[model samples]
Target: MTDGVEPGTVRPGGRTARVREAVLRAAEDALTEQGFTGLDLADVARRAQVGKTTVYRRWGTVTGLVADLLQDMAEQSAPRTETGSLLGDLTANARLVQRTLTDPRQGALFKALIAAATGDVKTAAALHRFYDIRVREWAPCVRQAVERGEVPEGTDPHDVIRAVSAPLYYHLLISGGRLDEPTADRAAEAAAMAARAGVFVRVGGKQA
Candidate 1:
Protein backbone atom coordinates (compact mmCIF):
# COMPACT_ATOMS: atom_id res chain seq x y z
CA MET A 1 0.00 0.00 0.00
CA THR A 2 1.09 3.56 -0.55
CA ASP A 3 2.23 4.81 2.86
CA GLY A 4 -1.06 4.74 4.84
CA VAL A 5 -3.45 2.70 2.74
CA GLU A 6 -4.30 -0.72 4.11
CA PRO A 7 -3.10 -3.87 2.42
CA GLY A 8 -4.91 -5.28 -0.66
CA THR A 9 -6.06 -1.80 -1.65
CA VAL A 10 -5.37 0.23 -4.75
CA ARG A 11 -2.47 2.38 -3.67
CA PRO A 12 0.62 4.01 -5.20
CA GLY A 13 2.27 0.71 -6.00
CA GLY A 14 1.74 -1.88 -8.69
CA ARG A 15 1.52 -0.96 -12.35
CA THR A 16 -2.23 -1.45 -12.53
CA ALA A 17 -2.93 0.73 -9.51
CA ARG A 18 -0.69 3.49 -10.82
CA VAL A 19 -2.36 3.38 -14.20
CA ARG A 20 -5.79 3.37 -12.59
CA GLU A 21 -5.08 6.44 -10.50
CA ALA A 22 -3.60 8.26 -13.44
CA VAL A 23 -6.61 7.49 -15.56
CA LEU A 24 -9.05 8.36 -12.78
CA ARG A 25 -7.36 11.66 -12.09
CA ALA A 26 -7.33 12.40 -15.74
CA ALA A 27 -10.96 11.47 -16.06
CA GLU A 28 -11.92 13.54 -13.06
CA ASP A 29 -10.09 16.53 -14.43
CA ALA A 30 -11.60 16.13 -17.83
CA LEU A 31 -15.12 15.65 -16.51
CA THR A 32 -14.84 18.70 -14.30
CA GLU A 33 -13.38 20.92 -16.96
CA GLN A 34 -15.47 19.58 -19.77
CA GLY A 35 -18.98 18.14 -19.90
CA PHE A 36 -19.86 14.47 -20.03
CA THR A 37 -20.10 14.45 -23.81
CA GLY A 38 -16.67 16.02 -23.91
CA LEU A 39 -15.08 13.25 -21.88
CA ASP A 40 -12.82 11.38 -24.29
CA LEU A 41 -11.14 8.23 -23.06
CA ALA A 42 -8.46 8.79 -25.69
CA ASP A 43 -7.75 12.18 -24.18
CA VAL A 44 -7.71 10.65 -20.72
CA ALA A 45 -5.20 8.06 -21.89
CA ARG A 46 -3.06 10.80 -23.39
CA ARG A 47 -3.24 12.91 -20.24
CA ALA A 48 -2.48 9.92 -18.05
CA GLN A 49 0.54 9.27 -20.28
CA VAL A 50 -0.54 5.69 -20.81
CA GLY A 51 -1.35 3.81 -23.96
CA LYS A 52 -4.87 3.85 -25.28
CA THR A 53 -4.79 0.08 -25.16
CA THR A 54 -4.15 0.17 -21.44
CA VAL A 55 -7.04 2.51 -20.87
CA TYR A 56 -9.28 0.45 -23.05
CA ARG A 57 -8.13 -2.72 -21.38
CA ARG A 58 -8.85 -1.26 -17.97
CA TRP A 59 -12.15 0.48 -18.71
CA GLY A 60 -13.74 -0.53 -21.94
CA THR A 61 -16.28 2.27 -22.23
CA VAL A 62 -17.12 5.63 -20.75
CA THR A 63 -19.65 3.94 -18.50
CA GLY A 64 -17.03 1.45 -17.41
CA LEU A 65 -14.59 4.25 -16.71
CA VAL A 66 -17.22 6.04 -14.61
CA ALA A 67 -17.88 2.84 -12.67
CA ASP A 68 -14.22 2.41 -11.89
CA LEU A 69 -14.01 6.04 -10.87
CA LEU A 70 -16.84 5.61 -8.34
CA GLN A 71 -15.20 2.41 -7.07
CA ASP A 72 -11.94 4.27 -6.60
CA MET A 73 -13.80 6.96 -4.71
CA ALA A 74 -15.25 4.36 -2.31
CA GLU A 75 -11.82 2.80 -1.85
CA GLN A 76 -10.11 6.14 -1.22
CA SER A 77 -12.79 7.53 1.07
CA ALA A 78 -11.63 8.15 4.65
CA PRO A 79 -12.76 5.78 7.32
CA ARG A 80 -15.48 6.91 9.72
CA THR A 81 -14.25 8.90 12.68
CA GLU A 82 -15.62 7.94 16.08
CA THR A 83 -16.10 10.78 18.56
CA GLY A 84 -17.91 8.79 21.32
CA SER A 85 -21.03 10.92 20.91
CA LEU A 86 -23.73 10.62 18.28
CA LEU A 87 -23.77 14.37 17.71
CA GLY A 88 -20.05 14.56 17.21
CA ASP A 89 -19.99 11.55 14.95
CA LEU A 90 -22.88 12.93 12.91
CA THR A 91 -21.27 16.33 12.61
CA ALA A 92 -18.16 14.69 11.27
CA ASN A 93 -20.20 12.63 8.84
CA ALA A 94 -22.19 15.62 7.65
CA ARG A 95 -19.07 17.68 7.22
CA LEU A 96 -17.43 14.97 5.21
CA VAL A 97 -20.52 14.61 3.04
CA GLN A 98 -20.81 18.35 2.52
CA ARG A 99 -17.16 18.73 1.68
CA THR A 100 -17.18 15.89 -0.79
CA LEU A 101 -20.41 16.90 -2.50
CA THR A 102 -19.40 20.57 -2.65
CA ASP A 103 -15.82 20.16 -3.75
CA PRO A 104 -15.41 21.64 -7.22
CA ARG A 105 -13.58 18.70 -8.69
CA GLN A 106 -15.39 15.87 -6.96
CA GLY A 107 -18.76 17.59 -7.19
CA ALA A 108 -18.51 18.17 -10.89
CA LEU A 109 -17.25 14.65 -11.34
CA PHE A 110 -20.34 13.35 -9.57
CA LYS A 111 -22.55 15.55 -11.68
CA ALA A 112 -21.08 13.93 -14.72
CA LEU A 113 -21.57 10.52 -13.17
CA ILE A 114 -25.15 11.38 -12.32
CA ALA A 115 -25.83 12.42 -15.86
CA ALA A 116 -24.13 9.29 -17.12
CA ALA A 117 -26.24 7.14 -14.86
CA THR A 118 -29.38 8.31 -16.64
CA GLY A 119 -28.28 6.35 -19.68
CA ASP A 120 -25.92 3.74 -18.26
CA VAL A 121 -26.99 0.88 -16.03
CA LYS A 122 -23.41 0.10 -15.12
CA THR A 123 -22.88 3.66 -13.93
CA ALA A 124 -26.07 3.51 -11.87
CA ALA A 125 -24.91 0.32 -10.23
CA ALA A 126 -21.61 1.91 -9.43
CA LEU A 127 -23.31 4.90 -7.85
CA HIS A 128 -25.46 2.58 -5.74
CA ARG A 129 -22.36 0.72 -4.64
CA PHE A 130 -20.72 3.99 -3.65
CA TYR A 131 -23.65 4.91 -1.36
CA ASP A 132 -23.74 1.37 -0.01
CA ILE A 133 -20.11 1.55 1.05
CA ARG A 134 -20.57 4.93 2.67
CA VAL A 135 -23.71 3.85 4.47
CA ARG A 136 -22.02 0.72 5.76
CA GLU A 137 -19.05 2.71 6.99
CA TRP A 138 -21.13 5.15 8.99
CA ALA A 139 -23.75 2.65 10.16
CA PRO A 140 -21.40 1.26 12.78
CA CYS A 141 -21.45 4.59 14.56
CA VAL A 142 -25.20 4.39 15.02
CA ARG A 143 -24.98 0.78 16.11
CA GLN A 144 -22.36 1.73 18.67
CA ALA A 145 -24.65 4.43 20.01
CA VAL A 146 -27.53 1.98 20.22
CA GLU A 147 -25.37 -0.47 22.12
CA ARG A 148 -24.49 2.31 24.56
CA GLY A 149 -28.20 3.09 25.01
CA GLU A 150 -27.74 6.62 23.70
CA VAL A 151 -30.47 5.65 21.30
CA PRO A 152 -33.17 3.10 21.84
CA GLU A 153 -32.81 -0.51 20.83
CA GLY A 154 -33.54 -1.71 17.29
CA THR A 155 -32.67 1.60 15.66
CA ASP A 156 -31.74 1.07 12.05
CA PRO A 157 -28.16 2.16 11.82
CA HIS A 158 -28.24 2.18 8.03
CA ASP A 159 -31.22 4.48 7.99
CA VAL A 160 -29.62 6.76 10.52
CA ILE A 161 -26.48 7.02 8.46
CA ARG A 162 -28.45 7.71 5.29
CA ALA A 163 -30.52 10.37 6.99
CA VAL A 164 -27.40 12.37 7.79
CA SER A 165 -26.52 12.87 4.14
CA ALA A 166 -29.75 12.43 2.23
CA PRO A 167 -31.01 15.94 2.72
CA LEU A 168 -27.56 17.35 2.12
CA TYR A 169 -27.28 15.61 -1.21
CA TYR A 170 -30.81 16.60 -2.13
CA HIS A 171 -29.99 20.23 -1.52
CA LEU A 172 -26.72 19.90 -3.32
CA LEU A 173 -27.99 18.14 -6.43
CA ILE A 174 -31.75 18.70 -6.56
CA SER A 175 -32.52 21.99 -4.83
CA GLY A 176 -29.48 23.71 -6.33
CA GLY A 177 -28.72 25.22 -2.97
CA ARG A 178 -25.40 25.83 -1.30
CA LEU A 179 -24.00 22.91 0.65
CA ASP A 180 -22.20 24.93 3.27
CA GLU A 181 -20.95 24.03 6.73
CA PRO A 182 -24.08 25.41 8.33
CA THR A 183 -26.16 23.18 6.12
CA ALA A 184 -24.07 20.24 7.21
CA ASP A 185 -24.59 21.15 10.83
CA ARG A 186 -28.32 21.49 10.23
CA ALA A 187 -28.44 18.07 8.67
CA ALA A 188 -26.55 16.56 11.55
CA GLU A 189 -28.83 18.20 14.05
CA ALA A 190 -31.95 17.12 12.24
CA ALA A 191 -30.78 13.54 12.06
CA ALA A 192 -29.75 13.54 15.70
CA MET A 193 -33.12 14.90 16.69
CA ALA A 194 -34.94 12.33 14.64
CA ALA A 195 -32.87 9.53 16.12
CA ARG A 196 -33.59 10.77 19.64
CA ALA A 197 -37.29 10.80 18.85
CA GLY A 198 -37.25 7.23 17.66
CA VAL A 199 -38.14 8.08 14.08
CA PHE A 200 -35.39 5.75 12.96
CA VAL A 201 -36.51 2.83 15.07
CA ARG A 202 -36.52 -0.46 13.27
CA VAL A 203 -40.07 -1.13 12.18
CA GLY A 204 -41.68 -4.43 11.33
CA GLY A 205 -39.91 -6.38 8.59
CA LYS A 206 -40.00 -4.09 5.59
CA GLN A 207 -38.95 -0.56 6.59
CA ALA A 208 -36.05 -1.53 8.79
Candidate 2:
Protein backbone atom coordinates (compact mmCIF):
# COMPACT_ATOMS: atom_id res chain seq x y z
CA MET A 1 0.00 0.00 0.00
CA THR A 2 1.25 3.48 -0.87
CA ASP A 3 2.00 5.68 2.11
CA GLY A 4 -0.91 7.91 3.18
CA VAL A 5 -3.12 6.58 0.39
CA GLU A 6 -6.53 5.07 1.06
CA PRO A 7 -7.12 1.41 0.28
CA GLY A 8 -8.17 0.66 -3.32
CA THR A 9 -6.90 4.10 -4.44
CA VAL A 10 -3.56 3.17 -5.95
CA ARG A 11 -3.53 2.86 -9.71
CA PRO A 12 -3.04 -0.73 -10.83
CA GLY A 13 -2.22 -2.55 -14.04
CA GLY A 14 -3.08 -5.69 -16.05
CA ARG A 15 -4.95 -8.19 -13.84
CA THR A 16 -5.19 -5.70 -11.02
CA ALA A 17 -6.75 -3.22 -13.41
CA ARG A 18 -9.31 -5.77 -14.45
CA VAL A 19 -10.16 -6.50 -10.83
CA ARG A 20 -10.56 -2.84 -10.05
CA GLU A 21 -12.82 -2.37 -13.05
CA ALA A 22 -15.00 -5.30 -12.08
CA VAL A 23 -15.24 -4.17 -8.47
CA LEU A 24 -16.08 -0.60 -9.36
CA ARG A 25 -18.71 -1.71 -11.84
CA ALA A 26 -20.24 -3.93 -9.22
CA ALA A 27 -20.25 -1.04 -6.77
CA GLU A 28 -22.06 1.08 -9.32
CA ASP A 29 -24.61 -1.66 -9.84
CA ALA A 30 -25.19 -1.88 -6.09
CA LEU A 31 -25.51 1.87 -5.75
CA THR A 32 -27.92 2.11 -8.66
CA GLU A 33 -30.10 -0.78 -7.57
CA GLN A 34 -29.95 -0.53 -3.80
CA GLY A 35 -28.28 2.78 -2.89
CA PHE A 36 -25.33 3.33 -0.54
CA THR A 37 -27.11 1.85 2.48
CA GLY A 38 -27.17 -1.50 0.71
CA LEU A 39 -23.57 -1.47 -0.50
CA ASP A 40 -21.59 -4.33 1.03
CA LEU A 41 -18.07 -5.59 0.41
CA ALA A 42 -19.13 -9.24 0.37
CA ASP A 43 -22.05 -8.56 -1.92
CA VAL A 44 -19.90 -6.48 -4.26
CA ALA A 45 -17.32 -9.24 -4.27
CA ARG A 46 -19.97 -11.73 -5.19
CA ARG A 47 -21.32 -9.46 -7.89
CA ALA A 48 -17.82 -9.10 -9.31
CA GLN A 49 -17.10 -12.81 -8.95
CA VAL A 50 -14.07 -11.96 -6.84
CA GLY A 51 -13.08 -13.22 -3.41
CA LYS A 52 -14.63 -11.41 -0.49
CA THR A 53 -11.30 -11.34 1.30
CA THR A 54 -9.73 -9.48 -1.59
CA VAL A 55 -12.49 -6.90 -1.56
CA TYR A 56 -12.22 -6.42 2.17
CA ARG A 57 -8.43 -6.14 2.07
CA ARG A 58 -8.37 -3.72 -0.84
CA TRP A 59 -11.32 -1.48 0.08
CA GLY A 60 -11.33 -1.89 3.88
CA THR A 61 -14.84 -0.53 4.28
CA VAL A 62 -17.86 0.49 2.25
CA THR A 63 -16.95 4.16 2.65
CA GLY A 64 -13.47 3.55 1.27
CA LEU A 65 -14.91 1.61 -1.64
CA VAL A 66 -17.39 4.37 -2.37
CA ALA A 67 -14.59 6.93 -2.26
CA ASP A 68 -12.59 4.92 -4.77
CA LEU A 69 -15.70 4.53 -6.89
CA LEU A 70 -16.16 8.30 -6.99
CA GLN A 71 -12.51 8.75 -7.92
CA ASP A 72 -12.90 6.24 -10.74
CA MET A 73 -15.99 8.06 -11.93
CA ALA A 74 -14.10 11.37 -11.96
CA GLU A 75 -11.37 9.83 -14.09
CA GLN A 76 -13.88 8.31 -16.51
CA SER A 77 -16.14 11.32 -16.95
CA ALA A 78 -16.40 12.68 -20.51
CA PRO A 79 -13.92 15.31 -21.63
CA ARG A 80 -15.11 18.85 -22.09
CA THR A 81 -16.44 20.11 -25.42
CA GLU A 82 -15.15 23.13 -27.34
CA THR A 83 -17.57 24.83 -29.74
CA GLY A 84 -15.52 28.01 -30.44
CA SER A 85 -18.03 30.13 -28.52
CA LEU A 86 -18.79 30.47 -24.82
CA LEU A 87 -22.52 30.02 -25.14
CA GLY A 88 -22.12 27.05 -27.45
CA ASP A 89 -19.60 25.44 -25.16
CA LEU A 90 -21.73 26.09 -22.10
CA THR A 91 -24.77 24.73 -23.92
CA ALA A 92 -22.89 21.56 -24.77
CA ASN A 93 -21.85 21.22 -21.15
CA ALA A 94 -25.36 21.81 -19.84
CA ARG A 95 -26.80 19.29 -22.27
CA LEU A 96 -24.19 16.72 -21.27
CA VAL A 97 -25.07 17.16 -17.57
CA GLN A 98 -28.76 17.00 -18.42
CA ARG A 99 -28.29 13.76 -20.31
CA THR A 100 -26.34 12.14 -17.50
CA LEU A 101 -28.79 13.23 -14.82
CA THR A 102 -31.77 12.04 -16.84
CA ASP A 103 -30.43 8.61 -17.78
CA PRO A 104 -32.25 6.04 -15.64
CA ARG A 105 -29.25 4.15 -14.29
CA GLN A 106 -26.97 7.16 -13.98
CA GLY A 107 -29.72 9.25 -12.46
CA ALA A 108 -30.45 6.69 -9.81
CA LEU A 109 -26.76 6.21 -9.10
CA PHE A 110 -26.27 9.95 -8.59
CA LYS A 111 -29.28 10.18 -6.35
CA ALA A 112 -27.84 7.40 -4.21
CA LEU A 113 -24.46 9.08 -4.07
CA ILE A 114 -25.99 12.41 -3.12
CA ALA A 115 -28.13 10.78 -0.49
CA ALA A 116 -25.09 9.02 0.92
CA ALA A 117 -23.14 12.26 1.02
CA THR A 118 -25.76 14.05 3.06
CA GLY A 119 -24.92 12.36 6.34
CA ASP A 120 -21.46 10.94 5.68
CA VAL A 121 -18.51 13.31 5.90
CA LYS A 122 -16.18 11.09 3.93
CA THR A 123 -18.76 10.48 1.24
CA ALA A 124 -19.52 14.19 1.06
CA ALA A 125 -15.82 14.98 0.64
CA ALA A 126 -15.53 12.37 -2.07
CA LEU A 127 -18.54 13.83 -3.85
CA HIS A 128 -17.03 17.31 -3.65
CA ARG A 129 -13.76 16.02 -5.08
CA PHE A 130 -15.64 14.43 -7.95
CA TYR A 131 -17.31 17.71 -8.91
CA ASP A 132 -14.08 19.63 -8.44
CA ILE A 133 -12.39 17.40 -10.99
CA ARG A 134 -15.27 17.82 -13.43
CA VAL A 135 -15.29 21.59 -12.94
CA ARG A 136 -11.55 21.78 -13.58
CA GLU A 137 -12.01 19.74 -16.74
CA TRP A 138 -14.43 22.32 -18.18
CA ALA A 139 -12.89 25.47 -16.66
CA PRO A 140 -10.56 26.03 -19.59
CA CYS A 141 -13.48 26.79 -21.86
CA VAL A 142 -14.42 29.76 -19.76
CA ARG A 143 -10.82 30.93 -19.89
CA GLN A 144 -10.94 30.70 -23.65
CA ALA A 145 -14.03 32.86 -23.60
CA VAL A 146 -12.09 35.43 -21.58
CA GLU A 147 -9.36 35.40 -24.20
CA ARG A 148 -12.01 36.14 -26.80
CA GLY A 149 -13.28 39.06 -24.73
CA GLU A 150 -16.63 37.32 -24.17
CA VAL A 151 -16.39 37.81 -20.43
CA PRO A 152 -14.66 40.11 -17.96
CA GLU A 153 -10.95 39.84 -17.29
CA GLY A 154 -11.38 38.74 -13.69
CA THR A 155 -14.30 36.37 -14.21
CA ASP A 156 -13.78 33.09 -12.42
CA PRO A 157 -13.61 30.24 -14.91
CA HIS A 158 -14.63 27.56 -12.45
CA ASP A 159 -17.64 29.55 -11.34
CA VAL A 160 -18.83 30.00 -14.93
CA ILE A 161 -18.49 26.28 -15.66
CA ARG A 162 -20.39 25.35 -12.51
CA ALA A 163 -23.11 27.83 -13.33
CA VAL A 164 -23.93 26.07 -16.57
CA SER A 165 -24.76 22.81 -14.80
CA ALA A 166 -26.04 24.11 -11.44
CA PRO A 167 -29.63 24.42 -12.52
CA LEU A 168 -29.66 21.01 -14.16
CA TYR A 169 -28.47 19.46 -10.91
CA TYR A 170 -31.01 21.48 -8.96
CA HIS A 171 -33.73 20.13 -11.20
CA LEU A 172 -32.50 16.62 -10.63
CA LEU A 173 -32.10 16.84 -6.86
CA ILE A 174 -34.46 19.55 -5.74
CA SER A 175 -37.57 20.87 -7.42
CA GLY A 176 -37.82 17.79 -9.64
CA GLY A 177 -38.27 20.25 -12.43
CA ARG A 178 -38.03 19.62 -16.15
CA LEU A 179 -34.63 18.63 -17.51
CA ASP A 180 -35.39 18.84 -21.17
CA GLU A 181 -33.13 20.24 -23.88
CA PRO A 182 -34.82 23.58 -23.64
CA THR A 183 -34.13 23.70 -19.95
CA ALA A 184 -30.49 22.91 -20.61
CA ASP A 185 -30.31 25.61 -23.25
CA ARG A 186 -31.84 28.06 -20.83
CA ALA A 187 -29.26 27.16 -18.21
CA ALA A 188 -26.40 27.70 -20.63
CA GLU A 189 -27.92 30.93 -21.81
CA ALA A 190 -28.31 32.21 -18.29
CA ALA A 191 -24.78 31.35 -17.33
CA ALA A 192 -23.35 32.87 -20.48
CA MET A 193 -25.32 36.05 -19.89
CA ALA A 194 -24.20 36.20 -16.31
CA ALA A 195 -20.59 35.67 -17.26
CA ARG A 196 -20.85 38.42 -19.83
CA ALA A 197 -22.28 40.72 -17.20
CA GLY A 198 -19.35 39.98 -14.88
CA VAL A 199 -21.54 38.40 -12.24
CA PHE A 200 -18.77 35.86 -11.70
CA VAL A 201 -15.99 38.40 -11.72
CA ARG A 202 -13.58 38.16 -8.84
CA VAL A 203 -13.24 41.34 -6.78
CA GLY A 204 -10.52 41.63 -4.15
CA GLY A 205 -9.88 37.88 -4.69
CA LYS A 206 -13.52 36.96 -4.20
CA GLN A 207 -16.64 36.93 -6.33
CA ALA A 208 -18.15 40.44 -6.61
Candidate 3:
Protein backbone atom coordinates (compact mmCIF):
# COMPACT_ATOMS: atom_id res chain seq x y z
CA MET A 1 0.00 0.00 0.00
CA THR A 2 1.40 3.34 -1.02
CA ASP A 3 -0.94 6.22 -0.31
CA GLY A 4 2.03 8.12 0.98
CA VAL A 5 4.17 9.87 -1.64
CA GLU A 6 7.42 8.31 -0.35
CA PRO A 7 9.76 8.53 2.62
CA GLY A 8 12.72 10.99 2.60
CA THR A 9 11.38 12.86 -0.42
CA VAL A 10 8.62 15.07 -1.72
CA ARG A 11 7.86 13.85 -5.20
CA PRO A 12 6.57 16.23 -7.85
CA GLY A 13 3.04 15.41 -8.90
CA GLY A 14 -0.38 17.01 -8.58
CA ARG A 15 -3.11 14.58 -7.61
CA THR A 16 -0.80 12.20 -5.84
CA ALA A 17 0.63 15.09 -3.90
CA ARG A 18 -2.79 16.38 -2.95
CA VAL A 19 -3.87 12.97 -1.75
CA ARG A 20 -0.73 12.70 0.31
CA GLU A 21 -1.30 16.12 1.86
CA ALA A 22 -4.90 15.47 2.76
CA VAL A 23 -4.17 12.08 4.24
CA LEU A 24 -1.26 13.33 6.31
CA ARG A 25 -3.20 16.32 7.53
CA ALA A 26 -6.12 14.13 8.48
CA ALA A 27 -3.79 11.76 10.25
CA GLU A 28 -2.30 14.65 12.19
CA ASP A 29 -5.73 15.83 13.25
CA ALA A 30 -6.82 12.37 14.32
CA LEU A 31 -3.65 11.71 16.26
CA THR A 32 -3.84 15.09 17.97
CA GLU A 33 -7.47 14.78 18.92
CA GLN A 34 -7.76 11.10 19.75
CA GLY A 35 -4.27 9.66 20.00
CA PHE A 36 -3.08 6.50 18.32
CA THR A 37 -5.83 4.35 19.84
CA GLY A 38 -8.31 6.28 17.73
CA LEU A 39 -6.35 5.98 14.53
CA ASP A 40 -8.59 3.98 12.19
CA LEU A 41 -7.92 3.73 8.47
CA ALA A 42 -11.55 4.14 7.50
CA ASP A 43 -11.94 7.16 9.75
CA VAL A 44 -8.77 8.68 8.40
CA ALA A 45 -10.03 8.18 4.86
CA ARG A 46 -13.30 9.81 5.76
CA ARG A 47 -11.55 12.70 7.41
CA ALA A 48 -9.29 13.16 4.41
CA GLN A 49 -12.27 12.88 2.01
CA VAL A 50 -10.37 10.22 0.19
CA GLY A 51 -11.86 6.79 -0.41
CA LYS A 52 -11.58 4.15 2.27
CA THR A 53 -10.23 1.89 -0.41
CA THR A 54 -7.46 4.35 -1.12
CA VAL A 55 -6.37 4.58 2.52
CA TYR A 56 -6.61 0.85 3.09
CA ARG A 57 -4.85 0.04 -0.13
CA ARG A 58 -2.11 2.56 0.56
CA TRP A 59 -1.39 2.24 4.27
CA GLY A 60 -2.49 -1.36 4.95
CA THR A 61 -2.22 -0.77 8.73
CA VAL A 62 -2.12 1.92 11.36
CA THR A 63 1.56 1.31 12.08
CA GLY A 64 2.45 1.87 8.44
CA LEU A 65 0.33 5.00 8.31
CA VAL A 66 2.01 6.40 11.41
CA ALA A 67 5.42 5.61 9.99
CA ASP A 68 4.59 7.51 6.85
CA LEU A 69 3.38 10.46 8.90
CA LEU A 70 6.72 10.65 10.73
CA GLN A 71 8.56 10.47 7.43
CA ASP A 72 6.45 13.27 6.02
CA MET A 73 7.09 15.39 9.09
CA ALA A 74 10.85 14.92 8.81
CA GLU A 75 10.74 15.96 5.17
CA GLN A 76 8.63 19.01 5.93
CA SER A 77 10.66 20.14 8.92
CA ALA A 78 12.09 23.63 8.89
CA PRO A 79 15.47 24.27 7.34
CA ARG A 80 18.46 24.97 9.55
CA THR A 81 19.26 28.45 10.77
CA GLU A 82 22.69 29.90 10.10
CA THR A 83 23.68 32.50 12.68
CA GLY A 84 27.50 32.34 12.39
CA SER A 85 27.79 31.45 16.09
CA LEU A 86 27.29 28.24 18.04
CA LEU A 87 25.08 29.87 20.64
CA GLY A 88 22.98 31.58 18.01
CA ASP A 89 22.57 28.42 16.02
CA LEU A 90 21.67 26.37 19.09
CA THR A 91 19.24 29.07 20.21
CA ALA A 92 17.49 28.87 16.87
CA ASN A 93 17.26 25.10 17.12
CA ALA A 94 16.00 25.19 20.69
CA ARG A 95 13.43 27.83 19.85
CA LEU A 96 12.17 25.74 16.99
CA VAL A 97 11.84 22.70 19.21
CA GLN A 98 10.22 24.73 21.95
CA ARG A 99 7.68 26.25 19.58
CA THR A 100 6.85 22.91 18.02
CA LEU A 101 6.38 21.09 21.31
CA THR A 102 4.30 23.89 22.80
CA ASP A 103 1.88 24.29 19.94
CA PRO A 104 -1.45 22.66 20.62
CA ARG A 105 -1.92 20.61 17.49
CA GLN A 106 1.70 19.71 16.98
CA GLY A 107 2.36 19.07 20.66
CA ALA A 108 -0.54 16.71 20.95
CA LEU A 109 0.37 14.97 17.76
CA PHE A 110 3.90 14.37 19.01
CA LYS A 111 2.65 13.11 22.35
CA ALA A 112 0.47 10.61 20.58
CA LEU A 113 3.28 9.49 18.32
CA ILE A 114 5.68 9.10 21.24
CA ALA A 115 3.10 7.21 23.17
CA ALA A 116 2.46 4.97 20.20
CA ALA A 117 6.16 4.36 19.72
CA THR A 118 6.61 3.25 23.32
CA GLY A 119 4.66 0.10 22.54
CA ASP A 120 5.31 -0.39 18.85
CA VAL A 121 8.71 -1.26 17.41
CA LYS A 122 7.86 -0.03 13.92
CA THR A 123 6.68 3.30 15.22
CA ALA A 124 9.79 3.53 17.39
CA ALA A 125 12.05 2.95 14.39
CA ALA A 126 10.19 5.55 12.41
CA LEU A 127 10.46 8.01 15.31
CA HIS A 128 14.19 7.37 15.58
CA ARG A 129 14.59 8.02 11.86
CA PHE A 130 12.60 11.18 12.17
CA TYR A 131 14.97 12.53 14.85
CA ASP A 132 17.96 11.33 12.88
CA ILE A 133 16.83 13.35 9.94
CA ARG A 134 16.28 16.40 12.10
CA VAL A 135 19.63 15.98 13.82
CA ARG A 136 21.38 15.70 10.48
CA GLU A 137 19.69 18.87 9.34
CA TRP A 138 21.23 20.86 12.19
CA ALA A 139 24.52 19.01 12.61
CA PRO A 140 26.14 21.05 9.85
CA CYS A 141 25.95 24.15 11.99
CA VAL A 142 27.98 22.38 14.68
CA ARG A 143 30.53 21.37 12.08
CA GLN A 144 30.77 25.01 11.08
CA ALA A 145 31.35 25.89 14.72
CA VAL A 146 34.21 23.45 14.85
CA GLU A 147 35.77 25.11 11.79
CA ARG A 148 35.36 28.45 13.57
CA GLY A 149 37.21 27.02 16.60
CA GLU A 150 34.20 27.56 18.84
CA VAL A 151 34.07 23.95 20.04
CA PRO A 152 36.95 21.55 20.52
CA GLU A 153 38.10 19.26 17.74
CA GLY A 154 36.23 15.99 17.36
CA THR A 155 33.11 17.24 19.10
CA ASP A 156 30.11 15.13 18.26
CA PRO A 157 28.13 17.58 16.18
CA HIS A 158 24.97 15.54 16.43
CA ASP A 159 25.33 15.19 20.19
CA VAL A 160 25.72 18.94 20.66
CA ILE A 161 22.75 19.57 18.41
CA ARG A 162 20.63 17.04 20.24
CA ALA A 163 21.70 18.52 23.56
CA VAL A 164 20.20 21.84 22.56
CA SER A 165 16.77 20.27 22.42
CA ALA A 166 17.25 17.62 25.10
CA PRO A 167 15.99 19.74 27.96
CA LEU A 168 12.97 20.91 26.00
CA TYR A 169 12.00 17.34 25.25
CA TYR A 170 12.68 16.37 28.83
CA HIS A 171 10.24 18.99 29.93
CA LEU A 172 7.75 17.81 27.38
CA LEU A 173 8.04 14.10 28.16
CA ILE A 174 9.45 13.77 31.66
CA SER A 175 9.49 16.75 33.95
CA GLY A 176 6.19 18.24 32.78
CA GLY A 177 7.89 21.59 33.05
CA ARG A 178 6.95 24.67 31.12
CA LEU A 179 8.31 24.95 27.55
CA ASP A 180 8.46 28.67 27.09
CA GLU A 181 10.74 30.79 24.94
CA PRO A 182 12.97 31.57 27.90
CA THR A 183 13.23 27.90 28.60
CA ALA A 184 14.26 27.41 25.04
CA ASP A 185 16.88 30.11 25.23
CA ARG A 186 18.18 28.59 28.41
CA ALA A 187 18.39 25.17 26.85
CA ALA A 188 20.48 26.65 24.08
CA GLU A 189 22.64 28.47 26.57
CA ALA A 190 23.32 25.35 28.57
CA ALA A 191 24.09 23.27 25.52
CA ALA A 192 26.33 25.94 24.04
CA MET A 193 28.19 26.37 27.30
CA ALA A 194 28.74 22.66 27.62
CA ALA A 195 29.78 22.41 24.01
CA ARG A 196 32.22 25.29 24.33
CA ALA A 197 33.65 23.56 27.37
CA GLY A 198 34.21 20.45 25.28
CA VAL A 199 31.64 18.42 27.20
CA PHE A 200 30.43 16.86 23.99
CA VAL A 201 33.80 16.03 22.51
CA ARG A 202 34.12 12.40 21.49
CA VAL A 203 35.52 10.34 24.34
CA GLY A 204 38.73 9.45 22.55
CA GLY A 205 38.99 12.73 20.68
CA LYS A 206 39.58 15.82 22.85
CA GLN A 207 38.80 17.31 26.23
CA ALA A 208 38.54 20.66 27.91
**Which candidate has the top score in TM-score?**
2
Total backbone collisions, model 3: 0
- TM-score sort, best first: 2, 3, 1
Clashes of each: 0, 0, 0
Task: Tell me the lDDT of candidate 2.
Answer: 0.93
**Per-residue accuracy of model 1 over 1-208 as CA lDDT, tens digit each:** 2566322233335667778888989999998888678888899999999999877766768877777778788978999999999989999999998998888788888788888777778778888998899899899999888888888888888888899999997997799987899999999999988997888887775453
Give me the runs in candidate 1 sitting further than 4 Å from their true place: 1-13
What is the lDDT of every predicted structure here?
0.84, 0.93, 0.88
lDDT of 2 by residue, 1-208 (tens): 6679888777778888899999999999999999999999999999999999989988888988999999999999899999999999999999999999999999999999999999999999999999999999999999999999999999999999888888898999999998999999999999999999999999999899
**Candidate 3 or 2, higher TM-score:** 2
Evaluate residue 137 in candidate 3 and report its C-alpha lDDT on the 0 to 100 scale: 98
Highest lDDT, which number? 2
Two-way lDDT contest, 2 vs 3, winner? 2
In model 1, the worst 10-residue window by lDDT is 4-13
Model 3, span 41-137: residue lDDT tens: 8999999999988777667788878888898899899999999999999999999999999999999999999999999998898899999999999
